[model samples]
Target: MPQKFVLRAAAIAAASALILAGAAGSASAHVTVSSPDAKPGGYAKLVFRVPTESDNASTTKLVVSLPKDHPFAHVGAQVKDGWKVVKTTEKLPQAVKVGDVTLSEAITTVTWTAAAGGVPPNDFDEFALSVGKLPEGVDSLNFPAVQTYSDGEVVKWEELAKDGADKPEHPAPTLKLVTAVTPVAASTEVDNPDTLARVLGGAGLLLGLIGLGLGLRAGRTRKATP
Candidate 1:
């Protein structure tokens, strides 16, 4: 009987562990930026992966706005089928030089509209861009994006993450820029504190489950030893 009790408790612990891990993954399963480690005064490929969040409507459009203060001197987007890409450039307040070339205007916004079919439910799409000369002395860059649904609903992802505060409901996608040597440090700096807490909490829960299982086994053994 004690052995059976131990096995059942082990099964429950495994199930609980799976649930905790799934929740941790789900927390980060939103719009995200996947790119190479960018350095100051360097170029990197910026790719945004967007998942369709609405169940009733398909994703029809995506609009990404770049930061004005730290503008990229050169920005270009990759071509994707079934999507019409549009880039809008605007003159900067002051001209900036890049590799002996003076740039008065820079790409500010990139929008992608569905050419024929939209991203259906449970689907995702990636948009790529080449950006050069990331602003120096900045830890990260936030690209505020807007997702448009076929049903005319607009979802904005522009909230910034603040320390010691709850994560925003619609957090904007951010790309971390690191220097040549301190790449690991940059990653550590970007780790969300809440995420660390969640991981530790999950570990604690698993340990507690194991302890409970052991206690149950002991109790069953005591009862059987009449």
Candidate 2:
């Protein structure tokens, strides 16, 4: 009975370890955005970090799908050495502004293709770009990306939620942005002015009343006893 109990305990421990390992793998597979919050009417430098699989194959290409309805959809990317960059443009219904400039069309997609053996196993790369003149009313920006492996397998990261939920199966690149608001100024005038004035005024009034009462009592005592 003792030996049987020990064997059953070992089997349970092994199953627990396998479950934990699978959870860790799923957590590590999501592609993440590194920079540039999507803000309206702002200029930002955006970066997407790509991690290749740790086992055998390296990442060969990264394709980022830009949002069609973004105010600054006409996007351009900074070129990287030894990597081929491609940009595809699309039309927009409205124009966005950055400072004093107005922008109409924007780039819809950007792709970065690595040279042969550029990204190796257990390594990573960053795709960066200079973008500006984002429109004013977006809370978050989502980029669904396609990551290609050397063996022709593709991983899609493109799940977004309105309620900000995380998708365990496929995750997309995201950026949270905040708009600038006016700040309140500190007041220097009336921290304790009313309290100080009331205390002093009440003390003076009480002393005057006490003096009058004492004078009347003294007169009455003199008149009755002398």
Candidate 3:
């Protein structure tokens, strides 16, 4: 009987660990950035994936901060149903230049408020942004976000993890700008990378056509001169 009890206890402990591992990697995991086209000096579709970790409270609001060190010239939010998104702008302490364009103000924070039903406990949602002229200086951008729950609980996702295994308790969502880097996979309520790929492909095609036209024009000019 003693041996049987020990075996049963060990099996239960293993099962619990599996459940936690699954949660940590899935629907109840950290808030993350899903960027398919995050190359430097290009426009990108950035999606913020928010998961409600609370067991009893519903997530009602989210506030994401855009760092000033790495700034974007333009920022816009994707419209999501059942949620109201507000982009808040603040005057920069110092004027920053972006590709010959000077700006005095910038969007510093984005907030999403639940309109109807907030994200229930253990459920997740996604918020998106369309930002242009991503800075070419940095290889990555960090976004610090806050999650508010209906039960008067606030969780801040702002830790900057050094590595995957050494991740802090609440690691902030980060987007890697290098095009070659493979992003970590996530499950549920994230933007589709295929849609972003199509948009970028169309842009590439347009540029190619423009280049071809310019080349042909130059050739014609040379022949006419001779």
TM-score of candidate 1 against the unseen true structure: 0.72
lDDT-wise, the better of 1 and 2 is: 1
Q: Please, what are the lDDT tens digits per residue for candidate 2 over residues 81-104?
A: 778889987676777554566657
Clash statistics: count for each candidate: 0, 7, 0
Each prediction's TM-score versus the true structure: 0.72, 0.61, 0.68
Name the regions of candidate 3 deviating beyond 4 angstroms: 1-20, 23-28, 163-165, 181-226
lDDT of 3 by residue, 1-226 (tens): 6999999999999999999898667744888997888778888999998888878988999999997866678999988788899999989989988766777888999999999679998888888999877888787899999999998889999988775576688889999877674556533223467766787899999999999999999999999995
Residue pairs of candidate 3 with colliding backbone atoms: none
What C-alpha lDDT does candidate 3 achieve relative to the native structure? 0.86
